[model samples]
Target: MTSENTIKNQLPDAISARVRSAKLSEGVATLVMDATGLARPQAEALEADLRGALEGAEGVSEVRVAMMADKVKRPIIAVGSGKGGVGKSTLTANLAVSLARAGYKVGVVDADIYGPSQPTLLDPSGQKPKARDKQLIAVDSEFGVKLLSTGHMIEPGKAIAWRGPMTGGALTQMMEADWGDTELLLIDLPPGTGDIQLTMIQKFKPDGAVVVSTPQDLSLIDAARAMDLFRQAHVPIIGLVENMAGYMCPHCGEISDPFGTGGAQAAAGQLEETFLGRIPLAMEIRVSSDTGQPLAAGDTPQGQAFAGIARKVSDWLKAKGSHG
Candidate 1:
């Protein structure tokens, strides 16, 4: 007979009933439970508790858990930028929304340690994520996108002064969070080719990475560095997206090259990869993202740009069979 304390320690926190445990020939342990009619948030909570149960189990190299589901399916993508200020966070938030709009389970990991903007880009002014078993519960942003950001973990007006180990530790927590039924995990990496980026790549083993850049030559050059970094990490480069590529004058019905157009596209060509598309220098995209209602949620020029990029992203993932 199992003592109450032993049972409580072994069982997941939110397990409504007995959990079936099995050990596979490959040494991977499987934990099964029932979660019918449970909401997404509750499922995430259950996942965290179940994962904790197998953390210290003997000879367990990996643990797989299922809750009222026959199989698991989710594709994780990493989005990187050469440097900051190219609207990478905005693009990440919007792109995640667009992918969800296409009926895929989506989540965004704001791994941008230096400047995490997901909290501002996706959630409102006063919202914050609460902790369950010291694990963060990813806030539900609109468009069915769940968001977790480093910015949300800090106090207001405080800077995160972290060394390589600290930053990597924080990132690990965010990546290992209970992302229940997430079909696509989009990681918004910090700009620049730094230790944090490399560490994240090694830890997560993302399926592919999307590089974001502006039309300017310097940004494009930085974007190339990002592409090379991912290649070195053995992660495939999905495609390149040109943000703020140009401006369309609504009043004059003329288009102008604000950041000088086609630089990202040309760079993608040089790298022998697909150039997803370009987003114009539009006010709607800026205002909407800033207001926590990303432009991709509606039919705007920027929204269309994000949709096009999402389609290209979907097609590329499908071609590589990464979506499975």
Candidate 2:
């Protein structure tokens, strides 16, 4: 067979799918890829295909595949849990606010497909997100971080009873929403390592994950399970956060450990993960979040704690660089 025919015969399936036509001259193979609506990942896949196939083809010294597409994939970090009421959503909201304060264009996706609470925490006014061509436009929040959530799409305080496919679809819509220049995305995943978590790990693919749990043995066990899911999926663990670590009495100067202290940190150590920090069980944090005013939006102690966590996450992202 001729060199050109041999090269065409050995083209990869990815190249065959995209190439509308192909030509060869000398030792170089040229391909006109029909990449009309491809995202960045698709274009990258095409590039990989050409590099792998044509580079090894007999007599082909170079390959050129021109692609046309209009999209980029941004970094996504997931804040998740193994069970409910671990304060993951609150932490996600405050972390977003803190990261925004630190000058990173951050966005939050409430992947809590069943128990989404980010709308209540970040955009409590009940403003629904707009859509264009079926892609959601993240709702603007008073906290400066854009948000897309099932909570935003549904009525307030109602439970979501969606099954697998429906939940997966909603999470995908939020995860793939138009986040504009948001450099960092925090997805507040639903409690437990279930379908939503699996979908995110397989589909959305967060750059890193911060697992949240209370300072208790049971909660720590569950948190570890969630962490294992991310680990198995090859997603980096940014850190483990011990929530409700200690509570200080309002009227007096007494510190209380209602959920027991240091459990999450010790778990992190055993798991060989970074301990991000602790967030005290504070009435101020609850009140602020309920009022659509994240404590991180202020300069209070509660705010400072979340700021510290955000800084650690930011440092992780910086260290991880463009890959994260």
Candidate 3:
């Protein structure tokens, strides 16, 4: 007769390494296997291998396997800008979608407490998050990204009017929410260096930051300030993104630089930071965002721009050995 000890000892090396706990009783063998850092297919394969190894064991008439994945500390990336309206939220939304499309489990926290917009941009269904055991569950969006935002907690068009501590508490709640199997979190920070930014730096401590700006001098100056804050905190500046770099006329197909071109790249060069890529000011992008459909969900030209940026970010993560 096969005892629990006998079954565990007989497990193949590969299967033994992943089996966390096992039991055998009344001709039934049950197993709990660790599936950490494994994709769905890999986890499934592991289960299959384990069942094959034990199904024919003496005194085992049935096999039950439960694949359990240990919670991992996912890397958090902050996406911030010097001021509002430079398309920081838009970039964050598309970047999350782009990363998800590239086979990553991504989540977004709309940390712009006073002006949360991720729920609007990623999930137009206006669904509120369900809570379990006092922890907030992240809302699922059709774009394959998870989201949590104050917008989901409040009525539409309601002013937040929160003080510094209140806003910090709100950020904390979202940051510590239940984000199962999320490999990366892109935090859409409120613009400028303020209470919320300071709280995030001192508390959550993001792994890196992506500063956004237009190609204009004013936006670049503010962007530099934002970068300086991250530098002071010793958080790596992943790179800079130039949003609204140029616009193409729908009528004549003429390319124009309304915010002035190449300024962000030049600024990056001078500051010794990487200029990840640029996103043009396209009408399609605006329309898609307004309609709660991320341009990066498709393969349009605008979508391709976001995809290119995501690739660069992924490369940076891989180089740093931070990508799992």
Best by TM-score: 3
* lDDT per residue (tens digit) for residues 210-311 in model 3: 999999999999999999999999999999999998999999999999999999999999999999999999999999988899999999999999999999
- lDDT against the true structure, per candidate, is 0.81, 0.85, 0.92
Cα error, residue 205 of model 3, in Å, equals 1.4
Candidate 3, residue 126: Cα displacement in angstroms equals 0.9
* Model 2 C-alpha lDDT per residue in residues 83-201, reported as the tens digit of each score: 89989999999999999998888899888777778877998788988887878888889878999888777667678887799999988888777676677788898898888889989
TM-score of 2: 0.78
Task: Summing lDDT over every window of 10 consecutive residues in candidate 1, give the lowest-scoring window.
Answer: 1-10
Rate residue 254 of model 2 by lDDT: 97
Off by over 4 Å in 1: 1-73
Error of 3 at 70 (Å): 5.0
Candidate closer to the true structure by TM-score (higher is better), 1 or 2: 1
Clashes of each: 0, 0, 0
Better of 1 and 3 by TM-score: 3
Worst 10 residues of 2 by lDDT: 34-43
